[model samples]
Target: MEWNISGQDFVTFSRFVGAALAMGLAAIGSAMGIGLAATGALKSMVRQPERQGEFVRTMFISQAVAESTAIYGLVVAMLLLFTTGGGHTDGIHGSDWVNGLRFLAAGLTMGLGAIGAGYGIGIAGTHAIEAITQRPEMSGVFMRTMFLGMAITESPAIYALVISMILIFVMGAPDAVGVFSGNIMDIARYVGAGLAMGAGAIGAAIGIGTAAAKALVAIARQPAKQGPLVRTMFLSMAITESPAIYALVVSSILIFVFTPTDAEAARIFGGMDLVAIGKYMGGAIAIGFGTIGAGIGLGIAGGGALDGISRNPRKESSLVRTMFLSMAITESPAIYALVISLILLFVFAVPDTMSWAQGWAELAKLLGGGIAIGLGTIGAGAGVGIAGLGGLIGISRRPQKEGAMLRTMFIGMGVTESPTIYALVVSLILLFVASSDVSTMSQGLHDFARFLGAGFAMGAGAIGPGLGIGLATRDALTSMAKQPAHEGALVRTMFLGMAVTESTAIYALVVSLILLFAVG
Candidate 1:
């Protein structure tokens, strides 16, 4: 077969050219936006040197936001220009049209998302600057608020990237190929989708720099408020870069989602048919949801900790310790989510589900395991709640003692939450580890896996009680702190009460460990 390249496919070339023009426009937009924001802040600072701190902070944030639209456009434009999958040969014009339309959609999505993020950050940062100017002492609070606001604003951008990626790869590539009976342009669409998201790297870089500059200025103006300011900056940056993470996600989707469709796949790959789709879908779901769960859980944990710190400034050390403990516990839910996802990837999504004997049985086992992982979140939440509540109470009573007590509490709380971790580990192993001669040669390993799972289920269920007892301990400590003269008697009684409360968590761990190792 001889394939001839034709210049008549000017439509594809034109689309690429349009993408370049868009990129240039976007750069101009960013430059204008940045210049406008910076000039305003600089002029304000010149008019009022005392307000320099405020203006600088505001400028940094505004510039970051302002530059977003241009960056997004640039990303889309680049995608269009660079992504031409395989060598192009003369093909039907309809395919070129599809590719062109897809690129346009991608450009629009990125552009809109960037604009939204920019506006959001500008509004929030401006308010924060004004607040700081009025009350320099409250800079910490203002910064934290600013970060949160910026994060929220960036969400739309993330959504845009996600949509753009889908349009370019999932919808565009396949449809273009179908319309034109498989042309180079179709492949180009997929590659372009990935390239479009690469712009996220630029956004992230600029965002981080902006955040750092703001933080530095804030610190320079108010050294005492440095701790809170740093924390706020970290959080804001995390949120800001979230859009970039989405870009990464979209890129990944683009790579996999456009795989030859069912009909085409059969014609090209020639396998058991339905098996591939199931496996791919299952794996996608598993990884997608699992990581999402962790991210959400962590976000909640971080927010709660931040709130606790802000509310009890004197007890920051204790609050921080509690935060760490809470985050660790919170991570359990994500671990379960991961376990479920991994199972989808490894077990449920197997290339040939029915190839093994008793296909239905294998399916049941895989699905049941995933469900168990998801359910594990309940226990993780309970454990974190317990530790968080107790830590808060302790810090509230004796702010000065927060540091010592916090460390102790976290260690104890971590130990208390150990069983949940063990459960997650076992679940992952089952999901990923191949079932083979080991099952036949040594029932111990196989039996241990199942036993451990049951132990984890029970162990996870017990986290609530464990937390309740910890909270009770905090109450007792608070009571004793109020009356130091009678501390001995209270201490003795508190220990007794704590011991009783701890018994349940202990029992759960013991049982889980025994099940995990000794039973077989």
Candidate 2:
């Protein structure tokens, strides 16, 4: 017996998988969020049996908000599966496979997008319940702050939803797959747009949620400082969401700009132009994964600032200033990531077609540059926050030792920032310095592995040192605050620890350098 398969069948099959992804990932986050809210409500009720009503009410509200993202996912899933699932013609036209990829990207965009927002909202809700338990009088304030944070946290997911909607309804809609899906480039655009917005939202949502949680507790501890704390919370959240905005901007460009016109599509039809694919998708990946660490770090620093101000209201100016500096350092990684993404999107040039060897090498180069910046920043971003938090903790405890502590903090932050700088350097070299114009298949594959390995080596290797140096700095600052007389000793110890901790990043740099220049 003989069997036959067609591209439209693949399209139909992809729709099923897309629906599953849309519903499945969406459910996981919302369920986790609901459980988190319930756990907090239960604990708060146990602490204050009489206030169960308020706790339950707040928990329910939080759960409801968290479910909204899942609902968006479900709506898209339903549409993908039911609205355009059947009764297709039998011909394999220009780009039915492109629609299949679009469906998958749309599903992923909505599904992964909701996770951070749902989880962040749950954290805010948990903090709200705890705040109420601590200060029953501040229930209203806690609830309001929680809601505000949850609202802001939803921004990333919303950007993702918009991208998903466009993927489904506009550019590569399943129903209009005949002419609209003319270009093979849509495959790159769809996947990149989905990834850019989807992964981008996670850290921002979580960061905003963290700020909200800290704000609620800060307000509860010092009810009179609610106004200023709330203001700080808003300011911090705004900054926290900026990384996601960068990703969203990149996604918008990928989806809207790279689309090939009908004539151009006719020229490039069914052609997997490797350079364009790599350039667009790599740009998306760079911004998408890169922003996560920055978002989380910003949240940590913001939370520290809120807590510090609550502890010593008179030193509000000092704490806020420190927060600005910490966040600025933390944001460096994301900036580097954004630069790589922009370069991939706008700066890199490619011809319409290439030799097989040439195409694959360029693909690897662009993708490697994206990976270098995106994965490399995670540790640097989060570590910066941890280190910054230590300084904030020290200053709040010993405000009189501001100048000494500030000096120590600055030194620590500078060291903490080194790994990200290394990643940035590695990414730049891959983008501009490395050679990829191979003439043979063996050479192309060699260069491909060379570039990709360098990226992974530097990116994965940088994470540990970024985190370690930050932890060391944080502990040193904390110790000095506890024992101001040991300031000199602590400062010396911190530098020593940082030097040792920095070795791993140096090793990554060495490996990356070898990969770029040593082989072939």
Candidate 3:
């Protein structure tokens, strides 16, 4: 049999794919997680015959919690499949492609995000069983910790849901005439917005999972210190989840805040030429990829801190304080990316009439600015994680010298973040100060070269500071652990070394700024 498919039919097919992905993937995850939890609980009940009723009750509650995300996905899928009038004559309006892409992106955002939440809940539930089995007397505390961790792990899934809702109800609304209207560029923008939040949330899921897993292991090891451990775990989870929040903010801005006004859309479709779609795509990539490193760093630092506190409960307060500071410092790079994305989306306006060469130059500038901030921050995040791990280890080994270790860690982290600051400066220059004098294709090529140079300057410069800060932190921690009494002097010396090492990053920032304003 031969099959004939028109363009409209393809749009219809895309809608079906979106609906299936949204509900099917989420349901699979929920089922797998709930099944794992039930199995683990049943096994535990068999081992502890007297607590069968309690195990069954806990398992049911956990399954209910895990099912909520899947239900949300199902609701969204149904709406897309049955309620949307994408196939109607008036609804197509040449915007079927945009609607199809929007639906697909929305489904991916919720569907993939829920997979992580499901696995996270399963990990937490499994560990909860082990913890309760080993320390029945502290089962109450274990249950509390497990629930809290699961809730934290579910945050990225919630972020995805919000993005999906925005895509469906706000952007794809039937009444919003001409919103999609066959503008392929606008359709791409919507797709980018969905990915900005959806793909970005992946790191948060992994980070939360790691933090929760560490918390359960710590509880199993030291059930008596569950209070402090749980507190620290929650705090770290909050910090770990921040990158996803940043992505959500960017996605919201892209969906509802940034777009062509009705008048602007009319002008674009009528003869006036404008080139700003690249800016939206650039902004999305900046926020989406920028947070992955920060998420991983938070996980490493938070998990290490929890482990350290479990080993030496006497240093709980000091260790937590140090971890908080380190996480904040580590987040600076992601913050820089957010700032750059906002500027790209809202501040930069394309000229009403421009040569193709000038348009290309503008695209290069926006993309270069994004890459400068996004790739430049990854190393800084890793550096901060290393410093945090060192601080945790030092405090656990020498509780009496926490003050000195914390001071050293702060100085080292500041040094590590200097490169990110430099990248921020370079990105600012590329966004606002770079010249776009492109009368010919050759000039546009030159402009592109300058933007690319600026990006590399910042990205490459970030590497040195990351390695330097990690080494400085390691040495300081080792010294404090070995000679607690000399902590004060060691901390002072480490600060001096870090300050000297940070000068290289500063030089690179200067060169990048020069390339932006002068060369480009």
- Give lDDT: candidate 3, residue 319: 74
Task: List the candidates' TM-scores in order.
Answer: 0.44, 0.94, 0.75
Give per-residue CA lDDT, model 2, range 1-520, as digits (tens): 8545566687888888888888888777777888898999999888889988988998999999989979978987987887573324665544677778888889999888888888888888888888989988767767777888889988888888888888887865333435332355678878998998988988888888888988888898889988889999999999999999998999999888876665546554321367777788888888998998899889989999999999989999999999999999888889989989999989976565567677778888888888888888888888898888888988998999988888888888788878888888888888899886678988888888898899888888888898888889889988998999988888888888899999989999999999999876
> How do the residues 1-520 of candidate 3 rate in per-residue lDDT, one tens digit apiece?
8565443565677767877888988886678778877987888988898988878887887788778768867977887787443543444543665667787878877876677677667767766776677777878887888888888888888888888877777775233344432264566578768767865676666677668867887878887887888888888888889998898888887787656566545443311122465577778777876776677678768887888888888778777877887788777777878888888887877555567677667777787787777777776776787788888888888877767777777777777777877777777777777777778988877877788778778867876676577668867887888898787788788878777777777777778877776553
* Candidate closest to the true structure, highest TM-score: 2
Residue-by-residue lDDT tens digits, candidate 1, 340-406:
5444544443242132223322332343344334333334434444445455555655566666456
Q: Give the TM-score ranking, best first.
A: 2, 3, 1
Supply every candidate's count of residue pairs whose N, Cα or C atoms clash at under 3 angstroms.
Answer: 2, 0, 0
Q: Which portions of model 3 show Cα errors greater than 4 Å?
A: 1-10, 13-94, 111-130, 173-185, 269-275, 441-520
Candidate 3 TM-score, true structure as reference: 0.75
Q: Name the regions of candidate 1 deviating beyond 4 angstroms.
A: 1-150, 153-157, 160-227, 236-264, 267-297, 304-329, 332-336, 339-349, 352-357, 378-386, 389-393, 415-419, 422-426, 429-520
In angstroms, give how far residue 92 of model 2 lies from its true place. Answer: 4.5
Put the candidates in lDDT order, highest first: 2, 3, 1
lDDT of 1 at 146: 59
